[model samples]
Target: MPFAASLASAAQQAQAAAGAAGVRIETVEDPERLFAVSRLLAEVWATPPGHDPLASDVLRSLAHAGGAVHVAFGPGGMTGATAAVFGPPRGHDLYSLIAGAKQGGRGVGYALKLAQRSWALERGVATISWTFDPLVRRNAWFNLVKLGAHAAEYTPDFYGPLDDGFNTGDRTDRLTAVWHLNRLGTPAADIADRPDPDAAPGPDGLPFTARDGRSLWCRVPEDIVAVRGADPARAVAWRTAVQDVLAPALADGYAATSMTRDGWYRLTRP
Candidate 1:
């Protein structure tokens, strides 16, 4: 199929998925709806007293300027939201700035993303890009496995210091993801043939670094949030270790291809 037709087909599939999940997704143009989105972001990310990342005015401006500020509603009111900024004209991509959901809101995040994709496709954008913390295992699964997005770049401390609930003490390293609206199957299908990494501990009860061919395996703590609370130094150690492994590998043209259920990042040379 041609690129535009394929993208349209993908968008239809996404809309179907959202409908099956029974969530109402909407673009926030009204001031009241935009404020609700801002409040949702504040509550979901647990922004500190004065550090709301997406204030009502910011969301309104983005929406008014042809960008997407989508909100998802469930039985319990607003459940999830996503915001994206348009890239430069030459880039032909939408940069998804942030997405978050209320805790325990199953399927809310996925539905919101489907809505974002559908909205972008209707506007003729074929690619959607976003940055995410590589250490978050569940996010890795959602972005790479479930949504069929690929990591294109890795940056160290991309946001300096994030004082939000999930990113309080950690350096803000992130993986930039590129989701091709016209080619969803390719990314998810590529995972099956890759070699698996061993997460077993070595002699010192520390996780072993494993590799295969041109691929390097890296690990994050199973529960980084709990680990950070119990042992800040250890959490930092994981951060530094991941940065050491991923930064150089990505710089050398290796991409994070797949993540294991046990939190291993498989960085492989193309």
Candidate 2:
């Protein structure tokens, strides 16, 4: 589709998503609204007092410089927020820095993302990229399957040791997700039939190797956050196991194409 037509379609989709989420999306420029976003994000991440992922002053600066800082407002006020900045000069890409939605708001995160996509498409940006912990299964499914993004790279300890509630004790192994603006709703095909039944098991009896050369399955903990809280040691072991399998595969020309609902990642080589 042409740029104008594509942007129009994206705008419609974003509007529909926001309506379905029971929220109103807005590109925030006011300092007070930006501060609200800061607080919302801090609460979502369970950050320590006075420690927010992105401070309001920083958000103001980004907004002033033409970056996007979108907030979602439901009946209870601000429920979600997302921030993205332009990538390298002439890169034609936007790097989404952070996004968080309050718990129990159905489709709120999805609405925020679609709003961000429309914002990017309107500016002629061709892609939006962000990083997420590869061990998080629901996030993998959301980014790769629901949003039609693809994993481009895997980096271990990408952010070092984060002090936030979610990343306190685990390695920050991340997968870079790239969303091509033109390919909305078209994710890479799932090639793996099923996790190899007879494959050798890794930590927690999860499959880690590619018995077949073209593709293979790697499993992650069903609920990594709960696992982290209940058994930190086991969580760390899961991290190391996934890193051992996925990092090498991504480096060796394999891309994680899709994630199963049950926490299996299908890493495939073209």
Candidate 3:
């Protein structure tokens, strides 16, 4: 599709998605609304009282300087929020810094992402990039399968250590997702082959290895957050296992193409 037509279609799709999710998307500019976004995100991340992920003053500066701070409002109240800024100099991509939705709202996060896509396309940006924890299965599915984005890089310890409720006491290994706005499509089909258990056993007894020369399969914990809380040592082991598998594959020119709901990351070499 041509750029203009594609952008229009994306906008319409974003609108329909928000409607289906039973939410309203808005770009808030004023201080009060921006502060609301900050508070909402803080709650979403379960940050400490004085440790908001993004401060309201910083959000305001970004908004005034051509960045975006979008909030999703449902009947109850704000259900989700996302903040993004333009990429490096001379780059035509938008980098989503943070996004989160309250629990129990079906499709709220998806709708927020579609909204971000439309927002980026409208401003002549063809790509939107973000980093997500590689150990999170649901996030892998959401970004790669649901949104049709591709994992472009494997970054070990991307954020060092985070004190947020979701990320404390864990290595912040990340997969950088690059969504090609114009090429959005349906969810990816399922992969048939399973990871070979004999290839290599990780610390947690999970398999992580390349099957054949062209593809690799890595496993993630079913619920990393719960594992972190229940057994912090096991959580660290899972993190190291995934990093041992994915980091080397990505470094060797393999891209994570699709992830299964059962927690398998399928990577393919170019």
In TM-score terms, which candidate is top?
A: 3
TM per candidate: 0.90, 0.95, 0.95
Which is superior by TM-score, 1 or 2? 2
Clashes in each model (backbone N, CA, C under 3 Å)? Answer: 0, 0, 0
Q: Candidate 3, residues 1-270: lDDT per residue as tens digits? A: 777889889999999999999999998889998888899999999999989999999999998989998889999999999999999977899999999999988889888989989988888898899999998888888888888888959888898989999899988888999888877654453556653555577666756554656677777888899999999999998888788778887888889888776777888875
TM accuracy, model 2:
0.95
Prediction 3 TM-score vs. true = 0.95
Order of candidate numbers by TM-score, starting with the best: 3, 2, 1
lDDT of 2 by residue, 162-257 (tens): 888899998888999988888766443443466354467766775555446567677787888898999899899888888878888888888887
Model 2 bad stretches (over 4 Å): 186-192, 206-210
lDDT of 1 at 145: 74
**Candidate 3: regions farther than 4 A off:** 185-189, 208-210
State the lDDT at 179 in candidate 1. 86
